[model samples]
Target: MTNRSRPRILLIGTGDTKADELLFMQRCIGEAGGVIVMMDISVLGDPPYKAAHDKHAVAAAADKTIEAVIASGDENSSMTLMALGASRLTRRLCDDGEIDGMITIGGTMGTDLALDVALGLPLGFPKLIVSTIAFSHLIPPERIAADLMMILWAGGLYGLNGTCKAVLSQACGAIVGASRSAIRPRPQRPIVALTSLGKSCLSYMVELKPQLEARGYEVVVFHTTGMGGRAMESIAAQGGFAAVLDLSLQEVANQLMGSVVNSGADRLMNAGRHGIPQIVAPGAIDMVDFPAWLPVPAELADRPFHAHNRLLASATSGPEDRRRIARAIAAKLAEATAPIAFVLPTGGIQQWDQEGEPLHDPEGLRAFVAEMRAAIRAPVELHVINDHINERGFVEKVLAIFDRWVADAVVPAGKVAVERI
Candidate 1:
């Protein structure tokens, strides 16, 4: 940790055009007990005041000069060079422990660069982007960093206004506050990355979390929703987990079905890429989620639907969809370099898929089970547990596999804490 008292915030923007807004945010950060480190990315014109790192410095960081950037001859190409430079410099700052957090402001162009910069930093570092299209669908899921924060830059396109000031002030305060309070991940025990939905749907986390922790593993359960799964995959890509219990496949189903509630294309492959031993399950793979507020799509209109709430709803997939997802899951697991185990619970996958629930489809469940049986083969061991996913027996099956792996030295053994008598 640095000896400095106040958090240092790196503020990046096109100073030539957003001088007033940048200066306003600088003052706001100051009042919130933060020091602003300014980096100007303007190519054509300069801001009224000098920035700590100007366009020439940014261009040089990319191994190019300001003249070379302007010589690129197009806005997109010029900005691409600047984006490269800004991301490299921001990462250098973070690696050197010079900046505590980062906040960038802009419309589309600045937001584009901000995404690259944010993605370059490690997880748990505070990175905020105040943009005109903060949550717009125009931004792809893969471009988003796991811990990035964003606020809509309302009414601040051309110049500052009362509404814009309100938004900017709140954003500045948030960045400063986050920088001060952010806790970097420092697990005491080895981390086990677990993925599941709510307790109402996938209940294994309820039992598995405490049991795993008692056995001296830190269980970090990701919700397997679109963003949650993406965050887990992000951390896993960095080799963050000792092992992965990917017990939910809803995001994969969402991706195959072309739903907006889907994680990126690389959903189920990250942990395996790092050779992390993982236990995989098809929990909730029979259903695809869409926003509840919207009308059901025509193709799935005839399928059994369940409204979890006003915000989210799910429709059961047909037998064919289940078969297709099974093959897809198997293909991803096939690429794993480490030991992989696939557990299939024959009775039911989710709470709502049991006998009398709204989403009850015994035939659909059977289809998934049969296809999974045929698809999972070779290096990936398959365990067919004939119990509902929420059943005690199913939990035992998972722990049994985990324990065997630990004993065989495939997984690191959990350490129970001992107290001095």
Candidate 2:
């Protein structure tokens, strides 16, 4: 049996003295069997003190050195630092454990540079920073990604002082331990992609989870935000999902008139190319979400706005918007080779679209149903039922459709025969 290879770490340091520090750090790193593949030093602004102290001799030494040197200066220079560091980090992560963890020791500017590198990595990757401003909340959260640990440093220089040694030791251990720990790689399960906005399809998820699990399918829910829809489509492109249950498609309305959750022009077309089984419903086709106080664009300012919460409001779509949305949805569905089913609820598409609700728009609903029926060319099975979006009857209908699909997918073996002997 072949032994597994140890992880390689890229140790990045700033200024000239880091070369000396690297020797010491390497000793500790070697104890854990870490292979330091690359050592890079930053030369920003002033030259190293050793060269300055040596005067004329320093200039000749700098020219003779063959080590890779990255220069840093103004804003653009700082950006270059981030870009180079991020490139190295990305290569290491991809080659190693896909970035199990990353640690950086720096000051304010260093923190800024390191944080930018962290942000370029994926969301769940571990990030650690040793900085003077560790306690400041002003640091942007986006810079840290998800798993971040920050340490405060009293002095800038690396010394043999008790505190400095202890801190360095801990940081090394933390990075190694985190990298060694079990990482939950993205699952390979047959993903069932479902779309929902917080408002309409919360109950749908609650009801759908058990039904999906009972049939041995993994449910992946995507909120109908701009990024959420894009992420689901990206995952589908990466062959993540076995099927898609697009329950709430408010993003279609948004895409039509340039609203917030507008998933680009491709939208559902990507899933079609992959030939994944898809079932779609116009769950929240009646509205477009936006911030409460932002002036609605001149074209849509007149549309009815309902305050869903203190900060969020949605503009109720008119008949025309719904028709446009339905057409777009149908166009995407037309491209699918896999089985496609669409369900329509006669009572309401969402709680706000029901009778007596502030956003009730019957004309919009009617136009949506009419346009979908007219545009779909792929023999879409449409079931119009008189039930609310979240009613028990509606959930049963959705589950039954999925169950039928699962049953049809099975190939049964059978034959009893008495052969002559």
Candidate 3:
């Protein structure tokens, strides 16, 4: 392929310090059938060779001069400024369809800018970061782009080495391949955003997915772990969904109760903020998840617990905690500008919360339901069902509201007509 037709990868790094490494990556990318569009984020000296977008151009993008950026007080502040400039320029490049994908090489400072750049890019645009701290806890879930790729910069802290070359080559090749192959989340049909855990915990998606598909809507299910909810909220913030079925709120509980295993504070508020039609439930809201490798907190020592896996575990919260969560959920739904519904399954929320299960607690469930009943007010319709959330009745309740909304033209109708086969 010609250079213009090849996948053009935006390779970002401090060219002054990483010229050798960046040049090697550019060569590798060329061999892998991709073209490199180099962006120099260095605030210090210049690269030996010229870059397409130099540090001066990066600073200019932020409406500041390179001198002003260098004069910024500390390294963190300077890098942050450069990150802002680079991110703005990169966004413009993507918007203008000048670049197909991006890859950045960095230690802590470069990685920090890399995270910002990744978050700034549109989802599914083939962003990758070769960082010394890939997968490190130093990076928070909210800062991560839903589709960003990362690889550990093995033996790459200093100059180039054999191990570093291997990592860099693979990262370059991966970004090139991804740019050529990534399937973006296009609205092929009227999209329905659904949130739930695995079928074992919240089985609504199992029935809901096929049922929604049959209605000629495309169903997108999000696992409500920390990152999953973040992805959903990110998409919702972009006004990506025709209707949102946000049935899982364990991440909300996790955030409220001081567990790191949570989405950001704005978990249940994105769709509402964007005025997207939403149907919400308290799926898995009674469970507070934490790292299974850690000891159970002293406060939750006596609560019923379920070991989800070696990496994740959850404990059923007390009545008071459930009441707090109910209030929070109510407050979030109250802000919806478009149509919204909250379904309260009085019997139970998740499978494990049923009788004879590990997390069964009727008292806690009652407290949550009672609090929800009190907290939910008009304009935000509350449908209290006697069946568990996983039951067919609960699904019917949701579908009834959805069908009405579609009929009333509140939610967009499915793009495809139902085949009468």
Question: Which of candidates 1 and 2 is the stronger one according to TM-score?
Answer: 1
lDDT of 2 by residue, 1-421 (tens): 1112344444444434444444444455556655543323344333233221121222222342222223334645544544454545454554455334455666666667666555455434545676768856546322343345677755546544566556666666665555555354464445588887874434687778767765666677888765577667656654556778888877777777776546656667666678777778888878887767776666667776688776677878888878888888887787776778888877678877767777777877888778877877756777777787878877888878877886787211112234589
> Worst lDDT window (10 residues) for model 3?
1-10
Error of 3 at 335 (Å): 3.3
Per-residue error for 229 in candidate 3, Å, reads: 1.2
lDDT per residue for candidate 3 within 66-158, as digits (tens), equals 999989888998999999999999999998989999999999999999998988888778899999999887887778887889999999988
Q: How well does candidate 2 match the true structure, expressed as C-alpha RMSD?
A: 9.9
User: Model 1 off-target regions past 4 Å?
Assistant: 2-4, 71-73
Tens-digit lDDT track for model 1 on 1-421? 5323599999999989999999999999999999989999998899888888899999998999999999998999999999999999999998999999999999999999999999888888999999999999888777788899999999977998999999999999999999998887777789999999888899999899998998889898999879989888888888888999999989999999988987788898989999899999888988899999999988899999999999999999999999999999999999988999999999999999988898999988888899999999898999998899999998899999998999998889787799899
Q: Model 1: which residue pairs collide? A: none
Stretches > 4 Å off in candidate 3: 1-5, 417-421
Please give the clash total of every predicted structure, in order.
0, 0, 0
Please report, as a residue range, the 10-residue window in candidate 1 with the lowest summed lDDT: 1-10
